[model samples]
Target: MLILKIFVFVTSAIYACIAKNIILIVADDLDVVLDGMTPLSSTRKYIGEQGVTFKNAFAAVPICCPNRGSILTGRYQHNHKIFNNSLEGGCYSQTWRAGYEKNTFATILKNRMNYNTFYAGKYLNQISITISWHQY
Candidate 1:
């Protein structure tokens, strides 16, 4: 089972690199039990069965905003400086509008790699509301 899982993960990564398109889904603060239940059942079935599962993956920052910042900028919260989910200072608006969005992996993919990126669901918590995702 472990070997099969590794094979699947490696294969999916190779295919993604070859295709130059990647879709990443991050569910914040959800219970692990959801993997065995309804709604996400199909996602588990398809993606798990076909793609890869990083069962032991770790988050850079456990909180929603900072972690999402890590994902967007590929930098840790210290560098991105979005310490928490607060809409106030040192948070989403300040961090993003301060120009962290320009050099993200997503922008590189969209501009250089010719990949169409789509971000769905909650973004940096409340700061998501203030910015236009289209510009990213």
Candidate 2:
């Protein structure tokens, strides 16, 4: 099935690569002891010399789909409002998803900032996750 892609317009009226490139990798069910208690905390001890970290970083929910929705949107799951793939029975299911379920941080950042966004991991209700495509 073809996923409907929404491109957010640049809020500044001009697309310029001014901000630092933030590469956030979200691995599900990852052992906290191994990677990090938070997204970039434990890992930061090693990379701290190179960048910043957040220990108190937490999500609205522990679930992958919603938690990711929070991280991407920088808002709670209720704000983004996408609970899971089960929404509308499924993203590409027989039923259609409401406008709310589709809103996300990545979508908004890309829309408002005109960011060339790329989501390379398994996401809740995502239409695609093929490695070859993500890599490209």
Which candidate number has the best lDDT? 1
Backbone clash total for model 2 is 3
TM-score result, candidate 2: 0.51
Q: Write the per-residue lDDT of candidate 2 for residues 17-116, one digit (tens) a residue.
A: 4565657777665444675346756655665546654456655777776675566546666666556656552333322234433455555556655566
Q: Which stretches of model 1 miss by more than 4 angstroms?
A: 1-19, 31-39, 127-136
Give all TM-scores, in the order shown.
0.68, 0.51
Worst 10 residues of 2 by lDDT: 1-10
Residue-level lDDT tens digits of model 1 in 28-97? 7555666343557777788767987766879999888888888888898889878887876356675576
Clashing residue pairs found in predicted model 2: 8-111, 72-105, 73-105
lDDT of each: 0.71, 0.53
lDDT of 1 at 76: 89
